[model samples]
Target: MTIPLPGLDLQQLGPEQSLRAFIGWWPDAQTRLYLAEQAVQAQVIYGGRMMHADHFHLTLAFLDGSSVSVLQALAENMADWPVPAITLDLTLRDVFEKPQVVWAGPDESQRQALTVLDQWHEDIWARLTALGWTQPPRRFRPHVSLLRHARIAADQSHRHALPTQAFVGDGVGLIVSVPGEQRSQYHLAATVNPGRAVS
Candidate 1:
């Protein structure tokens, strides 16, 4: 049986307060349908909250705590970033066992793309640090988040597996949102064409 997809709200905050680099692409109708089905299945089996598919995204970098001038400069610097087009073949594996959060991760073929992005992140980090900004404690790992805080039970019925889908993405975006707000909405600050824009 088919299931309905969850609804979500999108927000766009003004410039200079928050920033991030990301890829923006929604799943096709078929994929969304499949995700809705899986979400219902997971909700029934796992007995926990399921993440709304519309909230899904692949984050490239988080740009927080920059002054207005710095943010403008950074925006100008990223106005043209040259990264190649990437097609990721995502697969669902039992990566998270506790507090189950289902994820679709890249295959071995996408490692180079991820590595290049990491290096780009390092470069960005150096630039930010030179301008007196600190880096985040955790390193970058690319993955598609499917569920969050999904409590799992130690029972046979809880093992309902979800199907994964592949996505083709070509562009990168800058996202901004409020800090310390539980349901603060994210805004798309800017978009860069990876194949043509300079990094």
Candidate 2:
């Protein structure tokens, strides 16, 4: 994961202001470039609005409509959250019908990394619950969304195959979603490095 520089002034935010935010892992430039290339190919095969490279991320927790105070608290306590260093292999190309999205996810063969990631997800949610946030009941399905509004059938999702690509994920960031005319723009608010001592 890339350590993102602050893009929003959290200190300037008013207490009642609500933010559409989430904590996620940002890929390094090289990995992002690779994903962008894959997205271009996927768009040709799948037909959809390809997500911009800058918008690519692996979401951990979606905190929609979170109050400024809650966001601030999360940022302040971020260093205390567990961030296990893991390597994710993006080789599974698939689609979700409800959202009409094409995405890349780790294949089942990456057991060790997937296990660590699963535990880390649970740990983060445990910390979030202490901050008065409720964990969503939905199961965690980790994937990097590549295209939206895709017009591909379910079986066509496997028409194209991805070569083995791996990236080290060792950090997390708080990102605010800014709605745009075409798609939502994401702004990095704060980040915490992996293996930092918990306060």
Candidate 3:
């Protein structure tokens, strides 16, 4: 998978029996660096588990715990996905205190990309529903999670200043959760690029 950026190639590295799955995109290197910087600051203020750099992504859909057969069917249905290459600005540093998740989401200036994301999300949900998958109604928010289980003194949700970065989302992948040495790891099960799907 290739982003619309020059000389930047977003590779699809292709996971599980009964897996906790989701659909998301790994942003470009610049975006990763900015997110990393924010993660460091968030940890200092919030005291949380910062997501690993490799696990940085903006999830489009979360497919709870799914059987292997359900994952296979979803992969087959994602081949000709309608995700076009688009750029988004990560400006909002949002925090949900109850869940203790700090994330970076697109600001209002990236409305065009958000619209495309909303439509693509609906499309994916519809296709999976047609396959007899129980998809609950969800209000989609485009954000890359930075910190989880955050324990901060003040209500700093969307109050901290983070470096603004532009992210190029050109593809989507099916990911599963796996046990890891330090934390749970996100493994890619299958991926569809801007024009094609690969396993």
The candidate scoring highest on TM-score is 2
Q: Pairing residues by index, what is the TM-score of model 2?
A: 0.88
Candidate 2, which ten residues in sequence have the lowest lDDT sum? 190-199
- What lDDT tens digits, residue by residue, belong to model 1 across residues 1-199? 1112221122223444433333333344455545555656656645555556554555656655544455555555664655544445555433355547755556555676667657766766676577566778975766555666666555434322334466544345555553445654454544555334221
lDDT of each: 0.51, 0.78, 0.71
Model 3 earns a TM-score of: 0.82
Off by over 4 Å in 2: 1-6, 154-160, 194-199
**Candidate 3 structure quality by residue, lDDT tens digits, 127-159:** 878877777765787889899988855643355
Badly placed stretches (over 4 Å) of model 1 are: 1-41, 45-48, 64-70, 93-101, 107-110, 123-132, 152-164, 179-182, 194-199
User: Cα RMSD (Å) per model?
Assistant: 7.0, 3.1, 5.7
Q: Clash number for model 1?
A: 7
Error of 3 at 134 (Å): 2.5
lDDT of 2 at 46: 75
Instruction: State the local distance difference test value for candidate 1.
Output: 0.51
TM per prediction: 0.60, 0.88, 0.82
